[model samples]
Target: MVFLAPKKNLFNLYFLRYKFIFLTIGLLFVYILLNGDIRSNINVRKCFSDINVQNKIEDILLSERKPRKGKTIFFHETSCNIPDTLNHVRLKARQACAIESAALTNPNLDIYVLFASPKILNNQTITPILESILSYPNVYLRNVNLWSYAADTPIYEWFKDGKLFKSKYIYSHVSDFLRYLTLWHWGGTYLDLDVVMMKTIENIPPNFAGAESIYHVAAGVLNFDWDGFGHEIADMCLRNFQTHFDGYDWGKNGPGVITRTLHEICKTKQIYLMTRSRCFNFNVFQNETFYAVPYTHWKYFFDSDYLERTLEMTKNSIAIHVWNRYSSDTPIIVGSNVAYGVIAEKFCPKVYKSSGKYF
Candidate 1:
């Protein structure tokens, strides 16, 4: 009986051990299925990073309940191929002038320009732009060294389809630009040089955070809530850029990475996407108000006249943005008649002279 009992006891112990092993294996498989390998998936990683940043930016904004009274800072960075001479200077100057005029109309607000470190040229033009900004107490210039964080070679060169992709400098420029904002403005509006500030933006809603609510606002006409999610988004973008540095060269892949990141981060926090009414209209002028248009709607961007008509009809627009077509020298013209032409002339008279003048 004693020998038989020992054998039975051994059998029970082995059976229990096998059961436990199976249970552990089953749990592990479930975890893998549920969570997956997020880091390995570029899209997943991008989304994760974006959500992380949005939360951080929201935390910052929520902490500062009061409206920031400091000067509105307009920021920009120049890369190697961008012209620093006559044409480029004129375009940049026009943008600055438009913003400065808007600021002058509103005495309570000041506009300042922070010139990021010039990669293509020496610091010579920086002085002139600074001097020009000096005319107004609110308008000023500050230089930032973004190259410190940038990899020695462009991120695209490290990837396979780098040749097809553009905006390689976006990640690096945005990082340095935000860093300067933190140091100088702490919590202020950061306007893109290509954007034209149409109206005074003295009281941006605390929840709005200056980013376009409906469609994502272009980084160009961003309003940093200092307490908002700009920093977090910027940080996540940088990290993702480093991780999927090779994948960025795919056409639209880089921005796609950014968009995914923004959406994911915003979703996790339950931070509602900013609606068009909450922030400025992202694109299109309809019913006399700037409306948010999706990025995919680029095909509808007929020309400057079409944009101008849209602007004229828009009721409340914080700013008008001219993105994507930044590299083209000619005025963006679209449409096909006197009715459209009249509206276009109201905003941009020069469009009348373009090849598509009839349209």
Candidate 2:
């Protein structure tokens, strides 16, 4: 009985001495349970370390909402060359300039820049130019599946059959088809990535496009209303896209389809005559409004001497297509007095400033 009493006293004294340490451990456990992040333990952290996991998360976060048909401005990135290191779509300086300019010109409209291939975005992947454009509340960046984008539309079969991939000019042809599909699915203003908005297009006729020449209407700058005849034009263009698709002729599917459709609709060879004509439901603006500096004079954009002339020519232009096909190889030296440099500096200051030396 004496030995038992001594052992009991010893146990009681030891428990009392360490009671505060036990209490702290229990409280920490309760806190970990209360905080939901405890659920995101080692497994979650390990999963997030995978690039695909991060990409899927970003994809959902950046997904596009149902766009306002008439009020959305659409630009497409059809390239699939996402570098292994960069899972996000990286736009060139000129392309970023185009998007920012559109946002600047039409602050009320939603500007959508969709990528055809799946992209994973993170703080590291987003470049300064992309980050700058994303700062605009009206601008949205989304990764889109080309097949899903064309689904249920008349061009679905064509896209599914992989006809777009078999083209000699695959990227360009994909862009053309995607533009029509975009219009058919969600009617809106579709601009080529190379086209920079110089003025607000809010006042322009809802169903209008710029003429590339007296003979053909350009598809670079296109606006189709959400409903009524404009929608009808989009539908017809999709049908024509499928019916008259020719991978051999470069322009057959794009400019060719639009021009042919307009001729049939207006039943006039002189398509330019219908400009701003209230009698017809659709209008075509002069080439000077969009293609003021034509492809032939593409070099003028980089020439310092032509800066004043370029400004004068584009004074009345609502948008300018710098003919990326022709001028993409040409570099705009930073701090130069070239026309493109001046225009980009004023319209897309962030991208211009972020571009280190040349853009």
Candidate 3:
């Protein structure tokens, strides 16, 4: 009889032979799953200059006609590492709620929700949340190219040199820069994605930003028209951003830039005095107008016990900055007695109802 040799375990033999490779691939796969995107910091760096990259934005300065009625309200969605998973264009419930609140409250005011990438718009899928947001005739979703956006602006060189991706808070810093650039170019209202519009803001001062506190003037809700005082404020912000840009520090480039500009323009160290426009014409609204619930107590919006008190506190607020930095991880249960839920139900009923059990 022929010698019957036991069959070698080819799979185990191969695995053992390339165990290091397998381990590396396994770790990489796990990382992608955990991080939701596999692109490295290097890829982010490449994308900053990659014009061929599919994600792009339309030049609103060229395409969109100036609104004939109320001034345009702007909201920016910036993501450097966009995952290929479902449509990123589909706004999160919270984001949709925020947009819908603004759209519903200010029907006459043109609301532009600009995305940093075009992938979401290019996708064939139109998600429910997206449909709800688009239902508002005043609401428009457009893609924006950073290079094109920064072009003709003071920060153009900074972006051309690829310094934006170096920031630890890349998304926030890019947004901080874009807000000033867009406001400088078009002169409009810029609202943070985390804010919920409680009332119409079209009647508010043309160039205004709310103070998060006595010491800090938040950039979350900013309005700077393209000409006159608003133009002056936007110009100053662009100069300040270019003159003193810090990538490492979180707030330095954002609220810090605006705070510093306001200080210089108003010629005062104390921000509380800016509320009265003591030194300059730029209107600095009290914290209650936008930051009714300060960042330190942002959790109050999510707490059922504080729902009534928070609502009562923000009754006169034109908008509420939910301080997404502090309260994003906290869930807002649908139909719950939380301030966020109640506010969403009243202001963004469509988004709130579509959020199912949890928002």
Best by TM-score: 3
Per-residue accuracy of model 2 over 1-359 as CA lDDT, tens digit each: 35455888999989987997899999998898756443433222222222454554233223446678799999988775423444556789889999999999999899988766566667777888888898899988776666556778777886667555556676688788888888876788999999888899977768888788888888998889888888899989988988888877789988888888888888776867765554266888888889988887988888998989999999998888888988899888889999888888888888889877998
Query: Which is better, 2 or 3, measured by lDDT?
Result: 2
Error of 3 at 171 (Å): 0.9
Whichever of 2 and 3 has more TM-score, that candidate is 3
**What would the per-residue lDDT of candidate 3 be over residues 12-114, giving only the tens digit for each residue?**
6677879988899999999887564334555665443323334444446456554332278888887754443323466789988889999999887889887
Once all C-alphas are superposed, what RMSD does model 2 give against the true structure? 19.6
Please list the C-alpha lDDT of all candidates, in the order they appear. Answer: 0.40, 0.79, 0.79
Q: Write the per-residue lDDT of candidate 1 for residues 178-240, one digit (tens) a residue.
A: 433332335455555544445566665422233333343234444334433544444454445
Would you estimate the TM-scores of all the predictions? 0.47, 0.81, 0.83
Q: What is the lDDT of residue 81 in candidate 1?
A: 25
Best first by TM-score, ranked: 3, 2, 1
- The CA-based lDDT of model 1 is what? 0.40
> Which regions of candidate 2 fall more than 4 Å away from where they truly are?
1-52, 57-64, 82-86, 276-279
Ranking by lDDT: 2, 3, 1
Quote model 2's TM-score.
0.81
lDDT (0-100) at residue 332 of candidate 1? Answer: 34
